[model samples]
Target: MPLLLAFLFVSATVWVTRQAAAARTLTFLMTISTVVTLGLIAFFLFAEAIPVFERMGVRILLPLEGEMWDPNTNTFSLVPMIWGTAITTIVAILVAGPLGVAGALFISEIAPEQVREIVKPGVEILAGIPSIVYGFIGFTIINPYVSSELSTGFGALLPIGVVIGFMALPTVVSVAEDAISTVPESMKSGALAMGATDWQTMKSVTVPAAFSGISAAVLLGLGRAIGETMAATVMIAHVKELPQPAYDVFDSGETLTTLIAGNFGPAVGTEYLLSALFAAGVVLFLIVTAISITSQYIEERMKRKLGGEV
Candidate 1:
């Protein structure tokens, strides 16, 4: 029996290594299986979400006049959370976008080879750090700074958004740098030959050519910002209303992700409250999905464009 098991394992390994067709077929099956899990997730979210809609109608998503999202009074509004998500994402993108692009440009184009070697790996290392570390940092340091300096209170959006933006930076830098690096050297040479400086060539020839990929990187960062939960939850307050002024980022509030995450434990078997959280999950899922799909599409376009296929 031991000999038979060893033989089977060895034969399977040989089959996997030697047979390209079999290996590819197995990999394809694995990939398709992952798609099935994604489908299941979508199904579960909607399954859990639709009940809230049925019970409270669509107005549950819109802002109501009184206490927003009070499960006790049966008042369930999602607008405040939605607003929080939107504003935080916007601020994150704004903070991360230019800095990430600049970092990418410097590493891929301007930095010395030694500097690039050091900086690129360092930047990549940031991505490996856990989100909870970011949350703790925000909860401990940034939260207090913002509350004291900006008069925004403990859970203000400015600090939360900025922290989230830095969290998204590695993705933006990695993607954008790859895109910028793909620009043909000949393009830069041509621009330089036409009396453009290194800076001008980079601005005119490299950056413009790689703009689609950079845009995709920004969108990817947007997706990250939209989906961030733990950091925002730790950094934000459980404010149950929309900010008094619609555009106020300083006002403390919970995002949809934070709302669901903060409530999931307490909401166990609490019918409408559980449903409400799931409803928030549904909206969060859709927004993140749309941003990811759009980012992917743009990345594909960038690849095609860079390859001269488009």
Candidate 2:
């Protein structure tokens, strides 16, 4: 809709230019309006929750930071849920990061042109798959296998990490591939001309040149992994406990998204439960916002560096 409005405004400006000489002024006004609209939408997400947090008071943090997450008792300790999110996020990134980078390198640097053309579309299809489909696949295939064969009662983290890793793979691969593809041909040629192997050339020259893009890809994957609700909520059982039962990957644990999702429907009132839910949302919002801002900074730096405008 914004695009359509922008298009119509531009078209109207072009028509008005035939009658008046102030078309440039109209164009600038249109541009500023579009930016304001976008900024309003972005700002609303942060401002909407302030009232909820303000009413709850600092007493809310006691429960949020304490050992347990008993909303009925007016306790709102976020330690357990925070730990679950942090651990799973770390695990998913650890699994997805290197694999995504390698896949990007393969697609851009090593794959034959024809092979790349054929495979790249298929790679993108993975990202287009729905979160519910991933959840179904994890529940039917991975979860049961872990419970029946791997051990007695592990139900969450490892499977979710692996599945989220798969879901994140395409985003990372596509972004990193674009980064690698942008490396100057002269750089690659020079490395090869110096008798460096293809692998060495990619490792030393192409990878470093595209490091910012790869970093953006990893951060994007992190956001995707952290914010993922349906797949993680479905595949992992929701428990309020902090410590992992057995240091086992299969153990059930709750993430902030999972907790928000599973409890929001049943949670209500000015009670601890409702306050805790908002607190969880606050944590998720902060983490995702921080990551997004960092990613933008890296992307801008990369653009300036690559364009030699820095």
Q: Which candidate should be chosen as best, given TM-score against the real structure?
A: 1
Q: What is the TM-score of each candidate against the true structure?
A: 0.90, 0.82
In candidate 2, list every pair of residues with a backbone clash: 63-76, 63-77, 64-76, 64-77, 64-78, 65-77, 154-250, 155-250
lDDT per model, in order?
0.88, 0.80
lDDT of 1 by residue, 8-47 (tens): 6865886777887657765776688689989999999889
TM-score, cand. 1 vs. native:
0.90
Q: Give the local distance difference test score of model 2.
A: 0.80
**Model 1: lDDT to the true structure:** 0.88
Q: What lDDT score goes with residue 279 in model 2?
A: 73
Off by over 4 Å in 1: 1-18, 300-310
Q: Which stretches of candidate 2 lie over 4 Å from their true place?
A: 1-67, 152-154, 245-248, 268-272, 299-310
The 10-residue segment of model 2 with minimum total lDDT is 58-67
